[model samples]
Target: MSTIVVDHLSKIYPVAVKEAGFKGTLTHFFKRTYRQVKAVQDVSFQIESGEVVGFLGANGAGKTTALKMLTGLIHPTSGRVEVAGHIPFQRRSTFLSKVTLVMGQKQQLIWDLPALDSFKINGAVYGISDRALNHRVGELSEMLSLQGKLTQPVRKLSLGERMKAELLAALLHEPNVLFLDEPTLGLDVNAQVAVREFLREYNQRYGATVLLTSHYMADITALCKRVLMIHQGQLIYDGSLDRLVDRFSPCREVKVEFARPYSAHELSVYGDLQDVEKQSARFLVQQEGLTGAIAKILADLQVVDLTVSDPPIEEVIGQLFQAGTVAG
Candidate 1:
């Protein structure tokens, strides 16, 4: 069964408008005019329990708005949404306890106090018993490599450590579902990898469902096999990461290291040359022509090395967002 479901969900806002003139402004003050803007439009998808999925979009593409609706932070203007068998906006205790939302740029840990102190407060909010809270905190701290850091003031910890500690506080109750928005936002490479590993292991250990969004393709490619892409207030794509590339990416990249020097112009007959250095060239080949292009290259060119790969995930996704619709 799907642990998260969104059907025909939409959120709209009305903003007052005025023409660019003093007379227009005066008239608008007397009688206001408003325009309706769709922040999210008929967006829908489902996630089975224990699945890790990436939510992707450009800025103002409605990804965050959709997540907000799912977590009960904001009500939708229309449509139905449910998480863990409960209406999200209802904000029931059982539903709240079963789900967690973490925003990478935001902080919930009390800055002036040790993270341990905040955990106690979180425990109280969730009605966790003293003994259970202590045990849970200890276990989580060790898992996050935060055993000693918990006693230090949150402001004293590094950005990465603070993020890990924040995760500790958020997961104290062992929520069954996690909604993560750019969880590695400002983290360094190693720190980002650590968080990714932790999330993967946590999901595996407890079978928790996770919906993660990140600007870093590494995060998406590493943590999620499936992805959902939203653009201009609508979901444009949803499928396995590889399927996304296979569908929307109409071209494949072919790289050839020539045995002798070659210019891009010289390689144009073989394929649409995209780059050329002293001894190498990269071509963008139409998928349908990829095999024939490779055959031509092998037969004609003195190639020292050759390889084929799909376009970069970031590049493909950027093109999709720019096009404002999914295309094959």
Candidate 2:
């Protein structure tokens, strides 16, 4: 079943326009001129229950605006949005209870208080009984490896620990739908892996639906098999992650180590050389011509080692955005 539905959704903001210098300032003060800016334009997609989907876009690409609308934090300028069978912008209590939004840059826990105290307050707000709250806390803490960190003041805990506590507080009521933005934003490598593991386990345990947005490709690559790509406030591509990669990057990365140093110009005949360092070089060869290219390289050059693999997903997506080739 589809847990979230967005149809022809759009958000337009009326930004004030002003001229240059003192005259423009005086005109703006007296009678402000306004221009319409389309933050999100006619985006439409449906998310099935129990699926973890990646939401991809660059900065100022209307990703946050769309998330705000889906969470009922802000109303959409036009179109329909439903989450967990409830209209999101209506801000109904049952809908609110069924969904949770976690933004890494924002926090709900009080910095001066122990994390446990904040969790208690959240439990009260959600009307969870004390005994039930404690049980839930214990279970989640164990899963997060946050056994004794909750008792410490939030400010005193390490960044990773504090983030885990924030997640604990958000999941206290056992929300059925999660909208996470940059959940692993500023943690070390180990912390990122931990959070990803916890999320996978949580989805398996509860069958919860998740829609995650992150600039970090590792998060998406690790957790999401499907993705929805938005560009310039419009939904462009919605499909399997592997397909997106293959569609945008129709080539294989070939890394070759030569027995002797070779100039970049000397190797240009093999493929599109990306980099050359010492005796090692990287090239992007079309998948259709990979075998032939490899054979020619091996026959023409004194090669020590060679390997072929798909290009990094971040680079593929980055090139798409840079070239503005994504069509709505």
| The candidate that achieves the highest lDDT relative to the unseen native structure | 2
- Tens digit of per-residue lDDT, candidate 2, span 1-328: 8999999999999999999999999999999999998999999999999999999988888899999999998889999999999999889899999999998999999999999999999999999999999999999999999997888889999999988998999999999999999999998999999999999999999999999999889999999999998888888889999988878887899999999999999998899898999999999898899999999999999999999998888978887777656653
State the lDDT of candidate 1 residue by residue for 20-126, as single tens digits.
Answer: 99999898999999998899999889999999999999998898989999999999999999999999999999999999999998999999999999999999999
What's the distance in Å from true for residue 307, model 1?
A: 3.3
TM-score of each: 0.85, 0.89
Q: What C-alpha root-mean-square deviation, in Å, does candidate 2 show against the real structure?
A: 2.9
For each candidate, what is the lDDT?
A: 0.92, 0.93
In model 1, pairs of residues that clash are none
Q: Which portions of model 1 show Cα errors greater than 4 Å?
A: 15-35, 256-281, 291-306
Question: Candidate 2 clashing pairs?
Answer: none
Q: How many backbone clashes can be found in candidate 2?
A: 0
Instruction: At residue 293, give the lDDT of candidate 2.
Output: 99
- On TM-score, the leading prediction is 2
